[model samples]
Target: MTSVNDQTQIEQETGNTEGESKDSVKQEKEMKPEESNANSPTELSKLTKIVKHSKPEQPLGFDGFKKQYYRYASKFGTTLNLLVVGGSSLGKTTFVNSLIQGSLTGKKTAKTSDFMQHRLRMTDGDINFNLTILDTPGFGEKCDNSNCWKPLANILVQRLNAYFENEIKACRQLPIVDTRIHGCLFFINPTGHMLDPLELYVMKRIDRFVNIIPVIAKADMLTPEECARFKRNIIKDLQHEHIQFFHEPGKSIEGINYGMPEPFALIGATKGMQSDSKNAIRGREYPWGVINIDDPQHSDFCAFRNFLLYTHAEALIEKTHKVIYDALRTERLNKLKSQPNGFYTSSKKLVEEYMKAELGRVERSLRQTVQDKLQEKENLLAYTEKQLEAKHKEYEESLINRCNELKSQKQSLENLVRSDKTKKHSIFFK
Candidate 1:
């Protein structure tokens, strides 16, 4: 049933298609790589680029550096220094103990005002942290709490001074142990009212140098509603007073309370009371039931703790280094700018310059004093010589006058003798 002509046409068509495909393939093979590039702008841009699809042999990722840093940190643990200041009987000690359990031994105190520093090693998440807790006793406890902020301010200045000391060394220490106060937890008494004058003054005074975390201590004493009201009142008071706390700077906008609890209401757990629950959480024992410090309904302890350690630990440190520490550093540098060559000099270098200048001044002063004394002695001697010459001249003149007078007297006597001889005065002639 097949026609020979149709079959021949089909064969010719198939042959022609094969030849065309072969020709196109040959043309593609013959064309140079650049010649085959598209004429469209997008295609031309991509094809005309001299780069290759594969990345070169250069190492790009920071993973190696990151790992090295991590290893270094693990070897020598990271440090976090926290200063806790509050009035007496405000659970300062208890809260510190609970913050890093079993880290302290036998209340090692600083030289100032019952100020205790408990240094210990602890781990938070992956970081092996050397945590230092600075506690202040007898602060704001007196009837006249006006000058209470001084002691607190002194401690902060000491820490900053300490860092400055290490920083200015000729051969700087390999790892400058950063003992600067990273954060200050000011334990406000939970009166369910606004902050008092002393509290506000103390906070405002040191808040410039360190991060001040306004905490409502003994929050367990206040009811939920009362605690909430107190937090609000404290915020309003701080806002009204125009006080800056740690939380203020981290906030994206003004008058906004961010993720962290502002004026954190905290209830420190006492060992005397253990919860009757299966978990046996630490809390205060009440007549009716037990109050768990971890319970959010009870206090802001858990939230505060998490915020302190995990959530915003870096933020606190960052603010300290970037804002607080930088401000202090700039201030100190500005002060030092008054010194000779202090603008370009390190603190130690400035001190050395000052000492050299002082010594030079003393030497110059000594030389000048010695020169003055020598000049004075020379002038005195010259004056004495001149006076002696004038005295000698006067004596010579008097001697000549005396001689002349004597001669005149002798002559007169001679004439008198002659007259006496002439007048028969024998005794006068002898």
Candidate 2:
């Protein structure tokens, strides 16, 4: 009885504990609505602040990456890499200085026979983006232009390899620095002729790796008729050679169309022209009049500048990533995979072995299939033969039984006629 009473006390204590827990849960449920209602105004205020362009105390969406990039760019700025390839005295540096509106290079710059890098730190409106220039000097000046493009090619491949290396790594604490060039401004000399050997070689060498925009330098030196004829010849040559350039074939940028789809024939603006107007502009002052660089009748300088800086600036960088870098990445990966489709042969010996093994396996599978078919046919034939024999035996037994029954009937007739003593033997025989 004492034990029973103790069990009853234990049950009562557990029931009371469960009841207390349920009561506590109900209280929490009732208070949760009030708590949420009290904080609802704060949430609404946070949302209103976000709408007014102020950051919310809590993140409400996934613009974090964009914000991070904006912060990073505002702090350290971004880079736009460009390469300029042309002959000497083509006003490459002069054109750049005029474009930048300041002296990024020296006045009396020494003639460099090698590749040179120039940088300009300037604000493009509100954005602070640095411009990097790779200028190739002594291009056609050298007597032997045989391997002049090798240095440029090597540099391009080196940058691509660096990027690919950083991409394929398992883990990286820091982001990869994009040193790949965005575009190559190929300056073609206005000699009223087709593309030259050095120009073709250089353009073709780095065309697959980088974006190139051909510029016809010194358009003021050529007559209007000569320039038109020159552009036609260049177009014919480019089509004949099957060379791919930066933009789509037969397509021009909207509102930024230069003189032609390729080779914007524009005169490089002479920096600091002393014109009649009080304000100084980048142009040439002649005895007759001053020719403005931005004048469409004079050159396509303004249009080209608008396209390069304002219109297609981001497109240039994106093509470097999506088209050129993606192509490189695919090629590298395919070479590593060793595909046997004849496009790329990464490991010749391994591909051969793999194909040989596949062929052997396929042959064995076909052989097994033929064997299985033959075995199934043989089984059906044996079954048919057995059925045919059984049918023959059954027919033979029925015929024999019929013959025996006929003989027995004949004997019965003979016995009946012999017992009758009046039956004739001839009748029985008949």
* Whole-model lDDT values for every prediction: 0.72, 0.69
Clashing pairs in 1: none
Off by over 4 Å in 2: 1-78, 104-109, 124-126, 249-260, 285-288, 337-430
Deviating ranges (above 4 Å) for candidate 1: 1-69, 102-113, 124-126, 248-258, 272-274, 341-430
lDDT of candidate 2 at residue 98, scale 0 to 100: 61
User: What TM-score against the true fold does each predicted structure earn?
Assistant: 0.61, 0.57
CA lDDT of 33 in candidate 1?
51
Q: Best by lDDT, which number?
A: 1
Query: Judged by lDDT against the true structure, how good is candidate 1?
Result: 0.72
